[model samples]
Target: MHSFFVWYRVNRDEGDADMVIRGMMARLACRSGVGGRLIRKRDEPGLWMEIYADVADPARFEPLLRQAVDEFDVEMFIDGTRRTECFLAGDAIPAICA
Candidate 1:
């Protein structure tokens, strides 16, 4: 399974960004069959992160996530680019850990 961690800086009002992000997450869950969580730095509310855990198919999920972002105009609320990182299960690469 692949897990996605996306982080970005919110350029607009935190409350408005939060509302829009929540709605976008809901749409993703319905359309992509993957649920997501939104969080932020404790001291820096403008910096937000979205966590999508245990994604069985990143090929399908990543595009859907991008589509939803465009559909919801999520860029309007953010500053700079959204940085996305993906990870694999530790056991998937056990050879490297030995």
Candidate 2:
């Protein structure tokens, strides 16, 4: 499986952020092989992170990303910079044994 991470900051005072994110998560929950979680940083109030795990297939994933951007009006909520990173399980290293 591959993992996708998205980090961004939003203006919490704006009412749209929470609704958009919750709607996106609900949609993701119904899709097969796709799962994710939304997290907010405790230290950095507006900073948020989304982590997703599923089979690696850009063709399938890209559309979802685009849809979210369009439907959620993400441009309005997202702060200065938004970053996304994808990682493959094989690229990771386990802790070394003593």
Candidate 3:
């Protein structure tokens, strides 16, 4: 199995990361052929990221990726990366991706 991670940031408050974002994000994942997505909140400071994973082609996730920030505005800024060169080599997805 292969996977990728999408990293981004949002305020650590509710106003910016609202319910609409959650619903939309859930919907996007459903549409993308992904089983689901995992959302992580930083313990120390301002950071929000979602890791979308599955066996589907990454290209199919592009629309959801673009809509995440462009339309929903759930994040302040998104710094994304594809785990092509280096990736975790174990069963712990959260430990490696987060």
Error of 1 at 10 (Å): 0.3
Candidate with more favorable, higher lDDT: 2 or 3: 2
TM-score per candidate, chains pooled: 0.89, 0.76, 0.56
Candidate 2 residue lDDT tens string, 24-78: 7667545535767888899986898888877578568867776766766676788
Could you tell me which residue pairs clash in candidate 2?
A: none
Q: Tens-digit lDDT track for model 3 on 1-98? A: 44666555544565545465566567776677665454666583334445555545666566566675467664443334322221333575566565
Runs with alpha carbons beyond 4 Å of true place in candidate 3:
15-18, 75-98
Mind giving the per-residue lDDT tens digits that candidate 1 earns over 1-98? 98999999999888888888899999999998899999999999889999999999999999999999999899999899999999986655446563
Can you give the lDDT of residue 21 in candidate 3? 57
Please list the C-alpha lDDT of all candidates, in the order they appear. 0.92, 0.75, 0.53
What ordering of candidates by TM-score runs from best to worst?
A: 1, 2, 3
How far does residue 87 in candidate 1 sit from its true spot (Å)?
0.7
Clashes of 2: 0
TM-score of 1: 0.89
Better of 2 and 3 by TM-score: 2
Ranking by lDDT: 1, 2, 3
